[model samples]
Every structure is written in structure tokens, then in C-alpha cells.
Target: MRPEAEPAMKPVFAKIGKPVAAKFRPDPFQLASLEAIRDADCLVMAPTGSGKTWIAEEAIRSVFQKGGRCWYASPLKALTNAKWVEFGNHFDPANVGIVTGDTKENTDAPIIVGTTEILRNQLYDAMHSGENLNCDLVILDEAHFLGDLDRGVVWEEIMIYLP
Candidate 1:
């Protein structure tokens, strides 16, 4: 006699759902952070993948509308570059510039994106030259990296030096 055929096994995972076509809405926390930053200094602490970047974008938009400059510092070169590209797309390529140890372009753009260490060095230079950093808003991404033993000091220096 032939062996009985085994029953088909069920799939382990659920089928992927169709992508939702929903309009984007800002979260209350993001709006609050934007307002706080507009009024005074703000330290936003949220889990990764949350809308922390949205607050930064709105704040930068406000500054740009007033013809002011902005500086965005990230802990890693890759992150800085990614933001440089992302901001370029959002704010226009002509308005975005990047300055790092390896790359420097469009230094006079209204928006500058660079690594945290470069920002610290610029602060040092500005202090030595008795001049202020020509930026209205300064956003520090991956700020928790400020607690790192090796590079935390640079972040601390930036915090202390930036007005």
C-alpha cells in the first residue's frame, strides 16, 4: 500500500497587510517639542523611530522662513551625510551644506549639516576668533552618544560653547 500523503503545513507568519494610504499627522509630543524649542532650549528624549526628527524639521523650517541659518550635528559621519541628503530634498539642495573632516561644500548655505566633532571644532574656532556661530538653531542628533567615554567630551564641549 502507498504511504498516506502528509497534510499541508500552515504558514508560521501572517500575510503582509496592504500598505495604508493615510495622511501624515504630527503627534502631540512632536508639536510640544517644536514649541518648546521655539521658545527656549529643549531636550527631547524618546525611543528610536519616534518622530523626534519631525520636531527638528519644523524648527528648521521656522528658522529658514525668517532667513536664518541652522546647524545640525550628528554623532556619525554616515548619519550626517544622510541628513544632509534628506534636508537637501526637504529644503532644497542649494540651501543645504555639509562640513566634515573629509568633505566641505557650500559653506555659506543657510543650512549646515556636519558631524558633532566638526561642530565642536567650529565652536572652538569661533571662540578663538571672537565671533559667534552664524546659526539660529542647532540640533544635535543621537544626543545620547554624549555619554560615550571616548567622544562624549566633544559633545560636552559643544553644549558648553554653543550659545
Candidate 2:
């Protein structure tokens, strides 16, 4: 058999230009998430690129606008650091802080990003001190890690201790 063969379909060489600029509109589920977060605890589960981060940003925005505090926890330091920058861009650099195993800065900012372990430790400290966790809202990104074999305990502890 011949190893070389012509393409089955012609490549669209002309369709490779820059995509048309279009305004972004949230999906119905994203809108619903934003509404649900306003008055209640909400868990959003969607596929990648499905606007879960948008929902998070909006929730943080709502709280930040009202002079409230938000805690955003992810399972990894890399993700936590990325969100810190993203939230800083959306909410202003002075308003966002981060605390991980190796880094802690601006711990007094209105919006905080950190790993689940850090959050759990903070909860432990608050419990030990007889003080409440000073947070108005909490977002647990990569929340499915709650079922992970090794890391789930940290996430579970954070969930149990959060008020």
C-alpha cells in the first residue's frame, strides 16, 4: 500500500484570520449562578470554559462593592496565585491578597486568595482564638478535590470550619 495519501478534506486556508470581535454574554446558567450567590450558598459545577470563573468574579465583585470580604481558596498554590492576580485586576491590586505555604502578603485586603490548607489553618487559628472567620463570602475553586484521596482532608476541614 502507498504510504502517501492526499488529504480527505481540503484545508480552509482562508479561515485562519483573526476571529471576529464579539461581545460576551453569560450563559443562562452563569446568570442563574450570579443570582443564587447573592442570598444563599451556591455550588457551581460546569465544564471547562463554561464561565465558572465568571460566576466567581461576579460573586467577589458583589461582595467587594459592598465593603464585604471574600475568601477564595483553590487546591494548588499556582491556581491560587493566578486567581490573586485575576481578582486584583478585576477588583484592583490593593484590594486583593494572597496567603500560601510560602507566601503571605496583604493579609488584610478585602479579597483573599489562598490554598485550602492555608484557609483551614486560618480557621483553626480563629477557632483557637475564639474569634470568627472574618469573611462575608467564600469560593472554593477546584472543589471536586474535596473527594481527592490525599488533599480532600484539607478541603473537608476548610468546609467544616467555614461559617
Candidate 3:
């Protein structure tokens, strides 16, 4: 297909960039997402700037508060880097870590932000080794990519294996 014949791509700007609200209020969908997360796995789908990241932050915060671990997987390494910084700022720099194809740091931190491929690879290793992923909260950002022709399998595998 010609370049212009292909579908236009959505810009991967950070949705976690909104300025802090003085008295932030959760929208209904945000509330619903949080409610669902408390019991079992949750997949939050919403328009850009609709507080999905806030739901993720809140979920991570809940696990952090309990001294549990979290795995945040982004579809791209760059977005993984952004979440690393954003999470570090929100939950203390010492608690957040980054792992991508080229960089790995603070792997022992309670909150881990990395590419989906790394997370998927970790799950595979865990499965082969008969070990479970030591994470309490698992957030898969850019989950819409599960429809992608190439990288969707990574997302599908992670979802299937994550307990």
C-alpha cells in the first residue's frame, strides 16, 4: 500500500500531562474502572484526556501503599520512559524503575515501567521457570495496540498469562 493509503496514526503524546486539579474529581468511567480493578483484571478504554492515566496512577498507588509491586507496560519504549518519569514524580523516585531494550535501572523498585515486549518476555520466562510474576498491579498502557498486526501478540500473551 502507498504511504498515504495506510491509516493515519494517533500521536503518542503523554496523557498524564494534565496540570493538577485543585480538587480533582473522578468521572463516572474513571470510577467504574477503579471499581472493576478492585476485584479482578480491568481494561479501561476511553478517549484521550479522559483520566485513564489517573486510574492507572490510582491503581498503582493502591499497590504501592500496600508495599506491593506493579508492572507498567507501554507499547513503545519512549512512552515507557515517560511513565517512568511521571511515576517517579508521583510515587518518589526511589520507588519507580525503568527497563527497556537499551536501558535497565532500579529493577528492584516497587513500581516498574517498561516496554510491553519486556513484560511479555518476563512472563514467558516465568512460565518456563514455573514461577509467577511478582507483581500486584499490572497496567498495560496503549492497550488498543492489541489490534495491531505485528505487536498485538505480545499484549495477548501478557493478558493470557498474567495472574
Candidate 4:
């Protein structure tokens, strides 16, 4: 890769690299959650329209601001794709990314939205033998999804293995 290529991908490590093209104006609750995400491990259990997703965006921005990375794990493939598209529009696609069952784009983006199963599998493989995920944050949206019998175990396994 060219020298410039590395710098472009280094938003995960660069404080102020290329200017991100878009801006986000989150609601009050999301703003508050965003502000608090840096200080503690948060469990945001709010109503559906309470801007819970923006909290994840704030976590993404925080990680990028600190020269770190965020892994946005969602419960469903549709949610993952939706987040990927949403963030892509709000941020430079080069700096935003996605990973689903069959679709992987801009894997080097500072912000990444993916499926919980994919993230869990990666964590499990990492535990057994893989590249260490040195991310600065992990936002578990729809936290109450641990009740779905089909995919609940994956979520439980992820919570158990998180370090």
C-alpha cells in the first residue's frame, strides 16, 4: 500500500486526520448519553424513539476523536446494514464501515456496524487464536435482546467473554 493509504486508514489512531464530511445533531437524551459514554460502561435502556441509536454514534465519535476504534454490534443483519448506511451518509464513507454475513465494505473505517453473531464469532476466534481486537469501545444496542431464544446464547457468550 502507498504511504498515503495508511494515513487515510489511520483515523483509528490519528486525532485529527481528514475532515469528516458530515455532522450529527442528536436529540437531548442522545447528547447526554454520548457525553457519558467516555466516562463509564453504560447500559442505556430507554424507549424505542429515545434516540438509543445516537448513543452508539456518540460512542463512535468518541473513539474516533481519541484515535481509537469502535465495534458497533447490532442484533440483526438489517440493523447492521441500516447502521452502515446511516453512518456512511453522516460520515465519510472512507471513514465509515460495515460487515454483515456476506457484505464487507471499508473494513478500515473508524466507525463499523456489524452483526452481533459476527462480532461474537470474531471474539470467540480471537480467544482461541486470532488478531486481538484492540478497540476502545463496544456498544451493545437493543441490550434486552438477550431474551430471543434463537440468538440469545450468542449475546450471552459475548457478554461472558468480554474483557
**lDDT of the candidates, in the order given:** 0.91, 0.90, 0.91, 0.79
- By TM-score, is 2 or 4 better? 2
Q: What is residue 32's positional error in candidate 1, in angstroms?
A: 0.6
Which residue runs of candidate 1 sit more than 4 Å off their true CA positions? 1-20
- Per-candidate TM equals 0.88, 0.88, 0.85, 0.76
Compose the digit string of candidate 4's lDDT tens values, residues 1-163: 6456476667765866677788767777676777677677778888888778767766777678888988889988888888888888776678878888988888887777889988898788888885666677887767788888787887798888777
Looking at candidate 4, what is the lDDT of residue 91? 69
Question: What does candidate 3's lDDT look like per residue over 46-123, in tens digits?
Answer: 999989999999999998999999999998888898999999999998999999999999999999999999999999
* lDDT of model number 4: 0.79
Clashing pairs in 4: none
lDDT of 1 at 107: 86
lDDT of 1 by residue, 1-163 (tens): 8864344422322245467899999989998898899899999999988999888888999999999999999988898899999999999999999998899999899999999999999999999999999889999998888899998998899999998
Query: Per-residue CA lDDT of candidate 2, range 1-163, in tens?
Result: 8764346433554456678999999999999999999878898999998899999998988898899999999988899999999988888899999999999999999999998888999999999999988999999999899899998998889878888
Off by over 4 Å in 3: 1-21
**Runs of candidate 4 exceeding 4 Å displacement:** 1-32
Query: Could you tell me which residue pairs clash in candidate 3?
Result: none
Off by over 4 Å in 2: 1-17
RMSD of each: 6.1, 4.8, 9.8, 14.2
C-alpha-based local distance difference test score of model 3: 0.91
